[model samples]
Target: MTWQTGLSGFLAGLLISIVTAPVGVSGAVFLLPVQLSVLHVPNPAVTPTNLLFNVVAGPGALARYRRNGQLTGPLARLLITGTVPGVVLGAIIRVFAIPGPQVFRLVAAAVLLPLGLWLCARALRPAAGDRPPLTRRTILGLGLATGTVGGVYGIGGGSILGPILAGRGTPMTHIAPAALASTFLTSIVGAATYAVLALTTDGDIAPHWILGLLCGIGGLIGGYLGARLQPRLPEKALRLLLGSLATALAALYLFQGLNPSGGN
Candidate 1:
């Protein structure tokens, strides 16, 4: 990559990090397309590079959540249990699911659309005062589903998981941290999976690794600020922003899929 490319990626990462900071996500929703389209990174490098950012940016957010007492121990455990295996499987598929960028973009849009809408609805709806506790079984199911999507997209599934838990009546306060913890765990497995695949098949992924680290640096700062501001922000507004961002990204991916030539 040229110095210009690296600088652009860093700037983009910084902006995405700021946008995602209030939430527990690593900003892959914004970063991946830029890497693929603008930076012209290859398909093989996408997931791994995104995972690198997740690894770098995730810990600080998780730590903040833990410190704030927003992370639920048992819930996080349940989410990790289901997500780990699914993430592993998803990573393996990402390497082999070479139907071209068009197909992949479509698939990504399909997965993101529903998740975005769900988040939007939850944000707009009034918070229910009484809600059922999250059952282990329910968490397992959601985790597995979200993890699989994360594995394919290299997003760590916090975008989907955060809203689901919150909609189900898990306190918004806890949802952010729980999502962060879950994403952190799933990302470990997902990144490892991509690493193994890259080594066994594609040889070197050093460029992606380097870029991922750069992205992570931005994510770290953004995530820290977001965590710090969580208590002050209105829960509804937070959800709305996250959901809107997701929806916009989904649309962009869909547009790219339909007109690959226009992307970037």
Candidate 2:
């Protein structure tokens, strides 16, 4: 790759992680547009590439969270248990099915738009009396669903999980670390699944390793900085930010799905 392309990947990862890490997101979802548009990475391959980004980018914030004593928890474990298998399943479907982008984009938008609206609404409202605790089943279900989406989209599932958890009254401190940890692990599994499939399948299943690495290096620095900054921000602001990001992504997908020229 040219120096300019490498620099663009690095800068994109760095800037995006700095903004998203505070909310427990890996920012890979946001990077999808960059990969498709700016980097011109083709479909299918872009999914694994984003998963590779999470594998490389996730450790920075996770290390910081571990140092701060927020990394180990039941939530993270449950999420992993559900997401790992789900991601594997999703990867198989992605390679074998090769679902049309328009259909996927519309479905993704349908799921995200409501969640984003709900999160934003919840953030704006006064805190109601504490909600009932999340059942293990519910968490697992969420993990499975998000993991499948993550595998297909290569987002590591944190973007979906973080906002929903935050909206449910989970403390940002707990949610951020657990979500990042889950994302890191799931990405590893998802990437591995893709790599294994690449050996047998006919299409572009392998990731763009050099670009992924460059982006990951930048994310490593930026994620740590974002985690450091998170403690200082108010929970309300963080929730709002996550909701806005989700909403923006939903809009982007909706546009892509509806526009004849987009998401081919």
Candidate 3:
């Protein structure tokens, strides 16, 4: 890779991670499109590559949360338990069932579009009184759905989960730690599932280690700093940022699906 491209990626990773990680996103929510449309990375491999970045870069925010006593081990365990099985099942489906670009586009557009809109609504709507607590069934169902989307879209699912929890009036403290832990765990399962699929499917889905690490280094530092700064930022501001990012990307994906000739 040219120094120019590498530098671009580093800066982008740093900026995006810093903004997104504090809200539970693993940053691949933004990075995946950049990789595909700008960096010209192919699919299958793209998913795994993004997951690798999550694995590499996730610890900084996690560490911060742990040190701050916000990690919530029991809550994290509940999330992981629900997400892992779905992630495995989804990865298998992605590799074996809907491997084609056109189909994948439709699936991605369909899933992300609604989630993005939800986030936007949450960000804009007036604050309500206390929301009822989420049930165990509800959490597991959300986990299953998020894992499926993550497996297909090459993300850790925190971007979607974070906004949803925030919308439900969950405390940001519990939201950040719980979502990050779940995403990190799901990403690990997603990457492993892709590796196994690569072995069986006659495709090369192995991560681009050098590029992943380059972006990851920036993400690592950014995550830590962002976590440190999270409590200081306005809640509305963070929600708007993630909400806008998700909707923008969702629109782009939808447009691309509608006019393949117009896409990168």
Name the best candidate (by lDDT): 2
**Better-scoring candidate (TM-score), 1 or 2:** 2
| TM-score of candidate 3 against the unseen true structure | 0.94
Q: Largest TM-score belongs to which candidate?
A: 3
Residues 71-176 of candidate 2: C-alpha lDDT, one tens digit per residue: 8779889888878888888888777775567766776676568766876787798888767768999989989998887788787665577767776778878888
For every candidate in turn, the CA RMSD to the true structure comes to: 2.2, 1.8, 1.6
- lDDT by residue (tens digit), candidate 1, 1-264: 687887777777777766665666557777888888787877757877887787888876777777777775677777788788878777777777643678778878887787778878988877667677778887888788888888888887765677677666777676667777777778877888777666677543323876778778777777776787777887677667877877888898899889979664
Worst 10 contiguous positions by lDDT, candidate 2: 98-107
Clashes of 2: 0
State the lDDT of candidate 3 residue by residue for 1-264, as single tens digits: 777767767776788888987777778878877777777767666778788878877898889988899985566776777777877877888788877665666677776677667767777888888788788788778877887877777776655666677767787888887888888888898888888777778775777777777777778888888898898888777877777777788778878878878675
- Pairs clashing in candidate 1? none
Worst 10 residues of 1 by lDDT: 198-207
What is the C-alpha local distance difference test score of each model? Answer: 0.75, 0.82, 0.77
Instruction: Output the TM-score of candidate 2.
Output: 0.93
Q: Estimate each model's TM-score.
A: 0.90, 0.93, 0.94
Whichever of 2 and 3 has more TM-score, that candidate is 3
